[model samples]
Target: MRAFICAAAFILLAVPAWCGNIRLENKKVRFIFESRHGGLVSMEDLGQRRTISSAGGAPVWEITIGGRKVTGNAFSSFTHRQTAPGRLVMTWKGWPEAKNKDITVTVTVRLREQEALSDWHLAVEGTNGDQVPGIVFPQIGGLQHTTGTNLAVPNWMGELLANPGEQLKKPGAKFEWFYPGHLSMQLVALYDQRGGLYAAADDTAAYRKNLGVQLGADKKLVYYMVNYPDQTPGRQGYSMPYNAVVGAFTGDWISAAELYRQWGEKQSWCRQSRLHGNKVAGWLKSTALWVWNRGTSAEVLEPATDLQQRLGLPVNVLWHWWHGCSYDDGFPEYVPPREGREPFMAAVKKAQAQGVRSLVYMNQIQWGNSTASWKTQHAERYSVKNADGQPASHVYNIFTGKALTNMCIVTDFWKNTYAGLSDTVLNTYGVDGVYMDQTCLTRMCYDPSHGHPLGGGNYWVPNSGRLSDQIRARVRNGKEITLSGEGVGEAWMPYVDAFLALQVSRERYAGVHGWQAIPFFQVVYHPYALAYGNYSSLLTPPYDALWPAEHRPANMLQPLDTAFNRQFLLEQARSFAWGMQPMIANYKPLLATERKEEIDYLLQLARVRNNSLKYLLYGTYRRAPRMAVPEERFPMSRLSIYAGQKDKVTAFEQTYPTIYHSAWSAADGTLGIALASVQQRPYAVDMQLKAADYGLGNSGKIYLVHAAGRRELGSYAGGTVKVRFELAPREVCLVEVTPE
Candidate 1:
């Protein structure tokens, strides 16, 4: 075996070696490259005393060009040179015959001044009808076979791959981000017990290609970029300008997240000022109630008002299925059903009189089949087209058996329609704002006729921002009008006041391996925009009465399954801890139904978030410190509702010590902590609060409040305050610490 290994290494190093080996070092990391093979041999995290590299003979860069597999070993010549202090550049040139013609490829790898990051660029010349498929880093070692090693990717909310080797063997096992869908964010991180590595593609460049991460057959991790086809067939001298940041960190996933956060902050989209000021902030502090009533608009008003009065909290009411046509039956035609405009407007006025804000529903992407505008006028000119030039449509309402063709956001027809809807809802309907559906959730359109990029690129993100600005400009009489969408994406931050944040849940396909869902999105854009829990029974059913028996869809009404009870409460607790506004779906029937205990649980959680709005809504979120606990158990289950066989469900365990705790500091420099017990049984959590941990003096007094009964838990003073507190099942506790 040793002799065979040595022979393979010798064969891989057959090319001329300009420089035998090159070492690039900085204060944080050290990277070693083999010149002859043109591959990274060693990646060392200096502080953690760990090396992340394969056994040997592994190629760092692999590409498929001109129907030929080209790897680092395929290069006939190589040169390594130090361009600047702490920066090294390795260049490789090669020629491969395709269709009896030589295709020249030049690859450059530059280790940037930041020791943890490297930039790879490829240039291809003399291409005669030969296409470039992708470029991949085939082997990133120390990411597999380790006990604590995990892979983190931004999938729905975020995904963590714990059992790397086992996970890779699953069918269709890959993290893909192509344009036009839920791939709003592009980032991946692999970390272990010792340290971790973080990598992210340039978002601007990634739109032209597919960015992804997968595991090879040998169990090594791989990240690759698949280039798009040339617009003009038979074109030559194609230069794919793709760049990535590869870095090493010493802690858990948060350290790697910090790297991406710092990069995102410098982007142009994030720099734009938000649309609304204090009014938006006030809206963020309120809990949102999502109503999908099949009844009259007047029927929704009383329930929304009662819920606000009962909870003593403001509410943002999102009214769905209130249109004149059937549910999701028509788009850009938002006339009220049965009751018509007068009753709908009256309902909105009554809700506002009771201090409740209403937001009418609008579908941002879809042009419904039932609508006359789509059938008679703009389907060809406005609808999105697939790769086969077929119109893109989705079955938004399964029961209706109708499909809605997706609209190209960049088109003048869509812009004008959306702007008109915004004006009608805000001005005519007298609603406070618009709850635009699928605004950030839909995939990018590849409609060539729309005059945007062939596939989705940076166009959609900024265009959505412009639409938000246009709507805000039409706010009548300085009424606090807010704009919110289905989901949160970094690009929509400046435009949107809040996001439904439906991705943060215990559903299937949420993550990989035994991954636990964390506040990764909040860590980046918490104070900038508010996130609300998805409207579902997982938190609280939205209605006051039972679900209408005859009209209920078969899949809509779930069985009284006791198995998910504990998991449901835990998800709600996590939402509050992560600084998101807790929301209830279909509240009218829910409040009048038999689920009184569930309603109480939701109210308690809401009160906790409401009382600590200063810290959670306004202040910046800090990473929850690792707590010492006894026998931590992470449970996994099969998803009851799964689209494919590969889908699996994993439950997040927020037990004592590490119990769903989020720490923050308010504008007044007062440190606060929100903690909760998500289990079915009560738990006594021992907490050690250090003043210095919260940016305070060595000594201080920490005040505690139990949000359930609005009871004061007393104050303790010292440099380190050790306190033991008992919490009821699904109970939340809030603490405020001040330096004395």
Candidate 2:
């Protein structure tokens, strides 16, 4: 994090990190940007009486090209002037005629009431239109690091960092989030009790980007976004096709989410139809729990069947590792199943007959180097190549040393084979759907023969989205064949029926602990996509020791002999409260007789969800009212497969409330609120609801909904309605308010 100006020519501006001479304001917010009429400076929400940004910060904008770097003030010339009443245009040029080859950048800033709009354009006139690591524009700096200030990022599901300066400033803390992969969405919120600031790259074209707000050395927060422009050979210029927004609001993270949704709901991808338009199979709509299993029939079937019988709910098991070759080593060589074709097909039929729907797993991006297709199909010709002509490869399985090359899906072979393989799996195995792993995550490719930009371009996202549509339609065959993936992203929402969301509920992994998750994704797209699976964790004591070093967690914490349901109940309750399908992963460990208590709790949650299908599946997810309860500290441990069968693993001191709650509004113009108690004993819950606050209308009747049935509480014409109740251990409590 360098200061405002790094060059000697701009030494005068370096003393005070950020200086602003122009003032822009609306009734709610006051903004001061551009020191000498240039660079973003400070912001204050007048209604909240809080300043969202400080005075010291880095350069407002910067770019890198062909290994040369420059800032907004380092372009050898700079000028700005008012273009309209609330708009300003800034220009920079006069590059030295060396490797620079004469590049220029223009930025247009406009203040629309409470929000600020920043748009950018870059012109390249030389041989250095490549090697653009990233273009940092609309760089906002000087956010004060305080106790209550929090930052929310839209990761796999969503990640809410509490006191980022204190928690995220340590070494190894990940800061940057790249979209269409780790980041499922393009919005983030910086907020506290007073109010919040919302910022997003509101682009409909779906370009890849790095968005983050890190705690710098001085503890000052710096919010920024890295936009990768088209770095094609002989390209001349690139202009932002959309506006980047920063606005001030008077609410929590959910309020910030609604701002993004205003523009998000209108996008072409969502305009096609929301999730309730039956984009998924009829069975998938009512799916309540997902069981995740890998390996052969011996490892998958028995436990999956047991779980389905115990819960008495629709169970969709995502089965992995059925290919003939070893796990993670084979590409599409899926014939002669490892369990023996006859045995495997029989196993699928058995599970289906027992009401267990099977969704087969296949990696979408990788083509194993050890497979025959690598050479016979000429896949090496279309594989993603680095600048040095090496295959962009990844290695996870330790069985074979051969790597898996990321295939370019834009080719006919990649597209046809993916769809063809899925189609065959459904017809042959009589499975429900094909779960494509890592379909939304993309890599930079440099193979010019693929008709894409060398090393970098924005062609991957939209093309992959279209490929999903192709695969879905091919496998359907007039049936409700669903297309599922490992993760969720906005571009693929309209096409894919469901997505596995393990990253949201996993409290600790890869030796890092202390994760606080929020429902930022569901707040915006809960109804647009069906989310399931939290991986094989919680009561499941088995940890894969063969996992790669960087990914293996320190096991030994999950001791089966002294099994406890503390962590299990908390995580499942979170999944239910957040509107995700409650998942029970790796049913082997969960099948232990001592774990019957945990399994029964899962059954209770399933029953509750079964009764409220309309709200959980078809209703809009609303923000949960703030609940402040006493924290319960629990001790948790896990096993390490890579280290040893029994090495004493350090237990992370897990802290969470015993009660988890969520809210939703149904299409029938009613509100539903659910709360679950994960404590071993009992606890009392007291909360008040305002009709106007939750959009429950001016008059409504309150009713209590339990597993057995619904019971009337009372009626309220206006103002607040007080409801108090006590929940038994692992109890799921529901409240319904119907308009009069």
Candidate 3:
């Protein structure tokens, strides 16, 4: 680590005043602060020779207390001193009165020798009755020039805002997991041609409030770190104990992600995934089949068995709408099977015999208004309360106009209800697993009556985990039981064995300014939890027609079927590249239609994914170099042409190597590369590889395995091998390199 000490640069006397400013410099970056206004004057990326802040702009720290704005420049007195060798502390006292309160703000900035990152710690203390609504930081005015720049906002199921301000703005979006709800990786990055800037919080406790980013009317990007501190009429302080890092990197968006990944790897939360070793390898062989039908015992069993036989692989049935009530009509109430418990168990047992596991679906977040108990009992007491003390409601059945009130997971009533329900389901049905819907999808509760804190904290995650554990303990001895959730949530990773990932499909990337969906979540938690890919029914005509009208929500919009099918195939290929299990729902309805090509494509991908289980499923994911291929390879399909749609199908055609590649390595010295083609036509991709690239010697054999069979591509002679192969449309190719 390199260090620069300038003892004589600033006055060392008691007042310590050469100028009312201080500058901190490192090898890669420089930070200049104004003492009078307590604002960041400039942040210079020395390597790029660019400054992120404006000449005389407002400081990065903007505070709002009790609905009143308090700018750092409004403070009456400002003082600064060097706290440590690489650290500086700035304090401001006697701020202008806001919301009838006297306030003080303190900020600490630290820069390390070896890192291009700076850590910031902020504290706001008040002496009167006032509550804090939010805080903004590192206000870079240069972000207004949004020509080549991109902002990345992390969401559950790994969605990002690649084109930030261009998309339709929805303010107050909640980013959760450590703070509450689900999918809280707790990092945001902005990048352009001149490197990038990454900001993140390591402390989950201070991050409990709702966090969001918005493009202000001034065109500057603003961050909202919402907090709900109590308004006590005494000297009280709201302190952020965890340090926030704002770092610069030289590259594109991927480089920004790598910086955050490095910081995330050091946190304790990233290391808690329980799935490792043989457990991860076993999940690769498993495929999930979701059934959403109101049918008799035989109606469900026949199709599940057929899929198992057709695929010639292990399949699991995630049974929905098997109860007596209408689909999603009742919640916290698992009705007895329509035909009877005996027949239900018979169907489950029959499927289990054919290597099919049955998992019952239960709603974990809402209390159905249609339930008989809710009408008679005081269910609102257990529901989530907003800041205004009103219950939160979710409309589940739009046709019938039935809604479910969101429940507070921390309540005793919620815990008892789920515990009893799980016992009945597990012990009575003897199923292999349980699928909990909305387990971590909803926002945190601020209900004061829940016996927890007044404001939201980390109570929701641990309480939800306890509920999952209580249910898992009910499985009979010697029988393996799996716990699955609706979507991926980092806090729920330790409790869930699998996630029905609905966000990994193409529909998530369908808008004009929509982001290019990637498997970032899998890159972090692939070994810990198995993510089952979801397909959009809007893509396949027959599947879309089969959707029940009563079950369809108002927000559901159907895209063109032909264009959807094309993108759907590309999404499946991407999913496989990202180490996710293929999930096909409404199996019976879709199979009855004449969609043989789509079915075959799905089966081939599934077979290949299971076949290359060792590398695709268990190995750690690494970014692979781009493969060179022809520019204009194939023509656009006529199927994409539709009435009232003048837009050219954004799907790639002639692009070289239209294949997604993921590199991996295992502890047993096994090196592997998995590739999935996004192109619709058969094409050959040439890969240039060297043994040293994978930590191998000059002599080694590389085997290319696909549905056709495994064959030796060639051996590396002078430490290099140029392998060429043709992949069928939507085919997955696994290359295994063994050293001699």
Best by TM-score: 2
Q: Summarize candidate 1's per-residue lDDT along 389-418 as a digit string, tens digits.
A: 777877755445567888877787787778
Number of the candidate with higher TM-score, 1 or 3: 3
TM-score of each: 0.84, 0.89, 0.86
Q: lDDT for each of the candidates?
A: 0.62, 0.70, 0.62
- TM-score for candidate 2, please give it: 0.89
Can you rank all candidates by lDDT, best first?
A: 2, 3, 1
Tens-digit lDDT string for candidate 2 (469-492): 776666645766667877777777
**Weakest 10 consecutive residues, lDDT, candidate 3?**
636-645
What would the per-residue lDDT of candidate 3 be over residues 182-216, giving only the tens digit for each residue?
Answer: 44466666677676666666664423644555665
Q: What order do you get sorting by TM-score, best first?
A: 2, 3, 1
How accurate locally is residue 254 in candidate 3, as Cα lDDT from 0 to 100?
58
lDDT of 2: 0.70
Specify the poorest-scoring 10-residue window by lDDT in model 2. 8-17
